[model samples]
Target: MTNFNGFQKLIAIANEYGIICYATPEECLVASLPGYDDFLLAFSWSGAFEGEPPEHELIAISIQDITKEVTVAAWQIPTYLFGNVLRQAQMLVTAHQDFVLRTNNP
Candidate 1:
C-alpha cells in the first residue's frame, strides 16, 4: 500500500492553515477559498491506488481567476523522498493571503 504518512502531514498542515484537504483514490485537493478556482490546489499521486512504491511526482495546478490565468507546476522527487515535496506544497499553500487555521491540533 502507498504510504499515507506524507499525506497525513499535508492534511495537518492544511488544517493548521485553515485550508480544506480532501483525499481520494487518485489524489488530494486543497483549497482555501470556497467557489473560487483560483485558490484551489490539487496534488496528484503516482501510486495512489495500487499497492506499490509511492511515485515521487506532484502536479500542482494553480488557477488565476483574474486575467484568466492558469499555471501548471510539476515537481519530481527522487525515490523514497516525499517529505520534501510535502513541505514545499505546504509552504506554497501557506503563502496565500486568505489562509486560516482549520484545526485545533497542537
Candidate 2:
C-alpha cells in the first residue's frame, strides 16, 4: 500500500521543506511551509476495504506555540486535491523565501 508513487513524491515535498519527516509503518508524512508560524500539513495512508485500496488522506493541523495544543482543521483531501495543496505550499514557501532574501539583502 505504501508503494504508491504519489506518496513518495508527497514525502519528498515534506523533506524538501524540512518538515517532521519520518515515515512510520502507519504510512504518514507531515510538513509545514517554512515561512509560517502556525501551519501544518499531513498525509496518512488508510487501510483498504474490499478489493480496492483506500485513498490516502491529507489534512491540515493547527498548533499553539505556548500551550502545545494541536487542532486539526476541517480538511480531508483525496488524491485529486493533492496538487492544489502542493501548489499552495510551493507558492507560499517561495514567496516567503524571496521576502527573506530581499530583507537580508537590504
Candidate 3:
C-alpha cells in the first residue's frame, strides 16, 4: 500500500484519474448490487482502474482507531483481508463517502 501524505493527495489522484469513488451508503449498496450494474461497483464506478488504490479502497488497511470493523456497503472488512467482492464494494462506498466528507468539510 502507498504511504499517503494525507487525504488531499488521494483526492488529487482520484480527480486526475477520473476515479469515481462512491461516497454514499446508497451508492455503495447500489454499486454492490451485481445485477444492478453488472458488478462494476466492485471497482471504481468511473472506470479509472490505474494507480495504487486510495487508502480508503485498500481492504488490508481500512479505518483505524475504531472499536470494531466498520461495515461499508454489503460486507464486513478492515479487520480481515479475506473479504470478498461484497467487501470490496463496501470499501469503495466507504472510501468514496469519506472522500466526499473530507473534501466538503475540510
Candidate 4:
C-alpha cells in the first residue's frame, strides 16, 4: 500500500470510534473531533501498512492539550496495535473532556 492508503486505513479505523482524522499538508494525520479537537491529536507512522507491517516500525500517537497548553497523552506502539491505541485514545479524550467540563462548571 502507498503512504496515502496506509493513512486512509488508519483514518478508517479512527472513524470507527467517531474520531475524524485527515491528512494535513505536512503529511501528518490530525484529529478534528469535538472534544478532542483542542488536544491536537497527531499520528505519525513510518512504513506501516494494513497487511503485515514491519515489526520494527512504530506509530506515534500523541495528544497535546492546547487549551491547557500541555501535552496530556503520548504513545508509541507497533502498527498492529493501531486499533487498540485508537480505542484507548478515544477513552482518554472522553476522560479529559469530562474533567474539563466538571472543572469549569464547579
User: Considering every candidate listed, which one attains the maximal TM-score?
Assistant: 4
Model 3 regions lying over 4 Å from their true place: 1-83
Best by lDDT: 4
Q: Count the backbone clashes (under 3 Å) in each candidate.
A: 3, 0, 3, 0
Q: For every candidate structure, what is the RMSD over all alpha carbons to the true structure, in angstroms?
A: 11.3, 8.6, 14.9, 4.9
Give me the runs in candidate 4 sitting further than 4 Å from their true place: 1-18, 33-37, 46-56, 90-106
TM-score against truth, every candidate? 0.37, 0.41, 0.26, 0.58
lDDT of 2 by residue, 2-47 (tens): 5677568656655554565556566666555445545455565443
What TM-score quantifies how close candidate 2 is to the native fold? 0.41
Clashes of 1: 3
- Measured with C-alpha atoms, the lDDT of residue 34 in candidate 2 is 49
Q: lDDT tens string, model 1, 1-106?
A: 1557766755665566556667767656545344444544554343333554444334333422332343333454433453354455445545432233333332
Candidate structures ordered by TM-score, highest first: 4, 2, 1, 3
Q: Compute the lDDT of residue 22 as modeled in candidate 2.
A: 54
Q: Candidate 1: worst 10 consecutive residues by lDDT?
A: 97-106
Kindly report which residue stretches of model 1 are placed more than 4 angstroms away from their true locations once superposed: 32-39, 44-61, 64-106
User: Local error of candidate 3 at 57, Å?
Assistant: 23
